[model samples]
Target: MSLTLPASRLRTQVASIIEGTGSSPAEARQVADNLVLANLSGHDSHGIGMVPRYVDAAAEGGLKPNSGVKVVLDTGALLTLDGQRGYGQIVGVQAMELGIARAKAHGSCIMTLGQAHHLGRIGHFAEMATAQGLVSMHFVNVLSRPVVAAWGGGDGRFGTNPCCIGIPLPGAEPFLLDFATSRVAQGKMRVAYNKGEKVAPGHLIDENGAPTDDPGVVVVPQSNGLFGALMTFGEHKGYGMAVACELLGGALTGGGTWHRPADTARTVLNGMLTVLIDPAKLGTQAAFETEARAFVDWLRQSPPGAGFDEVQIAGEPERKARAARERDGIWVDDATWSEIMAAGAKVGVRITSAD
Candidate 1:
């Protein structure tokens, strides 16, 4: 079952916990807000569930404290940012800002980012551009190496490979589409492990290439360096996108491509590309948004499947989740809470109970 915590309380608590990692208060706040937003959007795996891992990474010297990001290259429309091993959220926001500004001037822009840890949701970045009355697309590949297997491979040879596209929708919320190419995100596996839950067969493979329900196989080194291989979501097509992301984000950005032992790496690296466009320059912005909203309305008005409530868009589900969590509380599973508490102890932070 999901564990619930007040949204504000959770964000504050997580922000404090992140501050213990030597991140600036601003960075900590940003990271916490992003994470909490992930949870509020129903992606618990990337939400507060990541606190323990971050804390552990901080303590183990895997993540440096108080690091700052910097731009390595900028040529008006093209930019390359080096995160300097700092908080990925902070770096990601900064990178998006550059892309947005450049796109505003040039009508399109591309950015290559390096030296950051697991940047959260790609949709968040896309929405950033969309909210500013621009269209945006993003491609993300893993860093510190890849930890997922290709479609037919047993070894970890690919990242989850998430991509997103967003379009401004005027009066309504922007149209945002985001997804990971993998059958299941790595964070989902981590969440399952935290909750001691079993996942579907074929979701993971043992060292011998046999399927295993035990989430521990992905964690324990003694399992024959046993790592789980994630199936590509759309078979070859998704795998192709994943490879492309690897090239664009990893190879293009000078980050190494996937290989063995990617999981035990030092810093998370992600390569990203963002493109932004202003609809007004192309044609009529208001008309485009109105037409798009009408189509969306028609699509949702269609009949829902059995046991379903209503049809929803990519961002709608997450938006609704955030609203609900804000009123109720952010769910934190027991295992995740325990991990957070333990990690907090190491960093001179306190994890208080709901009571």
Candidate 2:
């Protein structure tokens, strides 16, 4: 069964649990808000379902509470920030604040952030930039167990590794394109496993490297005590993009890559390399805005094909989901709810529905 509740009630419950983990009220609310926003935006894979893991990570001292970011290196148009293993919700915003300022001042800024706990949604940062009428690009790599397999390789070799780009549009919503290089995010597999659902083929391989339709192959251990792996989105092409993300976000950002074997660690870290640009400073504001608007109008003019409503842009789905979820409330499956309650219990907090 799934429990549906208002966003406000969910946020309050999640914040209470976060506070139980020794986070200040402010920090707890911030983290809770960020997680809930992910759900509101329709990416439940990156949403409140992650709280149980966060609770465990905090207890293990892998996720620091009430921590902030450290500026490791800074130039007018370049920055290197260390998250001090802080909550990514905080560190991500902090890094963007600095990067946006520099980008606005110098026309562009290149910022790399490392040592942050799961950064949740990279598109959030892009939205921040687009809200400022600036263009932004993000490359991020996960530091958790290697759950994604390379093109022809068997076992897991790397994390999902996400890439995102955001551009401002005049008289319309910005174009926000964000995606995981993997055929699907591991968290989505977890959700499927909990819900007892089978996934489409080509998205996963068994522990022995053969294709399978079971999401549990990646979500749980097999009889041999090993887990299966997820495949890239476009075979070799997506594999190439994931590799680039690992190299740039992990290695280039000075956030160490995952070279060790998979462990049972609940802490998932992230390294991000971000580039922000201001069109005003680039002297292309008028042209860029006009061209963007024209192309978006052109794209929307296409007729909807079979079983479709209309042509939509990359960001429209998320925005529509946010509006719908805000009105209809969010739902949590039985398994995820139990896990979250258990996490709260561990920290001596109790979670109950307002209903």
Candidate 3:
């Protein structure tokens, strides 16, 4: 079962709960808005379903409220930032703003961030860059847990490293692409478990290293005290990208790699390496926009393949989802709602639905 709530109501409730956890009103609003926007854009795995974990992390001293970022290195076109245990949504925006500023002045910037709490959605940072009229790409690695397996290996070896790229399209909406290297992100599996649903085949491998569609297999403990592992998307191809993300986002950003000894006592953290570019510096904005529009138009003209309705671009689906969700209230599954309510109660915030 699920309930529908207006985005504004949901945001207010989320913000209240986050604020109850010691975050300032502004920081709470930022975190709430980012999570709600993920749901609006059809990425529910990265949305409000995360509230419970965030709450627990705060209680455990893993996530700090209103923490500020620390600059580690500063060059004209390159920089590094330490999040100092702050909320990722806030720190990520700060780092990206710095990147955007440098890009505006130097025509390009490479920025890396380390020791940040879950950075919500990578696409959000890309969208920030696009909103600034800059092209951006981000590689992210989670440093807390390893839920994914290598191409042919059975045990868990890496996090669901994600990559995102956004290109400003001038007159049109920006072209944004974002995806997890795993066949499915761990959060998606958690969402499935919460909803009492199973995942698609080929998304998970059981403790015995056999393919399974049961989402619980990946999260629930087995008789031997081992959990299942998520598979890499596209076999070796996705595995390769995941490895690179770990190196660039983790090692390069000064956040240790996932290969470090498992320490269940440590808090979850994320590291990201972002590259921002000003197309105007390389070529005239007019020419770039013209060429981009032409290519997209030409590509869409191709006939759709079997079982397809139309040829869609990287950012089209998200735009459509946002429009529809804005019209209809966002949906919250029963289990996720229950968890949210409990999390709210812990923080002395009551979440009521306005349906």
Candidate 4:
């Protein structure tokens, strides 16, 4: 079962829970709004369902509250920072603010951030760069249970590593392409399991490496006490990309890759490699904007194909979702809501259903 709550109310409720986790009022609201925005953008996988995990991670002393990013190295266009396990919503912004300024000053900047506590949505950071008329790319790796299996391989080995790119389309919405290298995010499977639904084929494999449509294969331990794994999106191509992310975002960034058996640690960490480019500083501002606009228009001119209404850009769906969800309400599953309520109780905060 699901209940629809107004976005504002949901944000407030989530903020209250965050505050219970020892976050400041301002940090609580910021984190709450960021999670809610993910829901509004149609990516419920990265939304409020994560609150329960956050609470667990915090109580386990793995997630640090109110911590900030610490710069380890800064050389004009290159940066290395440590997140100190802080809330990703906070440290991610700090890293971007620093990287954005450097990009603007030097025409380009490369930054690596390690040890962030679940940097919610990578697209959020890309959007920040595109908003500033800069191009940005992010490669991020997850340091949690290895939930994604490699192509032609069996069992879990790595996370659903994600890659994102943002290109500013001067006169219109920017092209924001963000996706997990896996066929779908592990969190999406969590959502499906909560809803008692099955995912499409080709997205998952059972613990024995056999195929299965049940999202629970990855959500919960099976009878054998083993967990299934998500499959890579483009087979070998995606597997290769996931490896690259683990190398750059994990190894190069000093966050390290997942190698040992999945532990019971509630903390989920991320290592990110971000590159920002300023077109104006590259002496291609005018041509870049014009060409981008022309290409987008040309793409839109393509007639609707098959079940598609029209050609949509990468960022179009998220923007459309935001507009519609803002009018309607966000839906929270009964099970997820219950877990959230329990999380609130842990920190002495009371949450009433529908309150």
lDDT of 4 by residue, 298-334 (tens): 9999999999999998989999999999899888898
lDDT of 3: 0.89
The residue-level lDDT of candidate 1 at 40 comes to: 86
- Which sequence of candidate numbers ranks them by lDDT, best first? 4, 2, 3, 1
Cα deviation at 10, candidate 1, in Å, is 1.4
Cα RMSDs, all models? 2.2, 0.8, 1.6, 0.8
| Residue lDDT tens for model 2, 1-355 | 8888899998999999999988999999999999999999989999999999999999999999888999999988999999889999989999999999999999999999999999998899999999998899999999998999989999999999999999988877889999999999998998998888899979999999999999998887898989899999999999999999999999999987889999988999999999999999998899998888888889889999999999999989999999999999998888988988999999999887752
Model 2 CA deviation exceeding 4 Å by range: none
- lDDT to native, each model: 0.77, 0.92, 0.89, 0.94
Tens digits of lDDT, candidate 3, 1-355: 8899888998899999999889999999999999999999989989988898889889989999999888999997999899988999999999998999999999999999999999988999999999989999999999876889998898788899999999998678889999999988888898899889888888999888988888987766777777788998999999999999999999999976887544453356899999999988877788889999999889889999999999988888888988999889899989889999999999998776742
Compare candidates 1 and 3 on lDDT and give the better one: 3
lDDT of 1: 0.77
Worst 10 residues of 4 by lDDT: 346-355
Error of 3 at 177 (Å): 0.5
Clash counts per candidate, in order, are 7, 0, 0, 0
As a whole number from 0 to 100, the lDDT of residue 79 in candidate 1 is 85
The TM-score of candidate 2 is: 0.99
Query: Can you tell me which runs of candidate 3 are displaced by over 4 Å?
Result: 261-266, 284-287
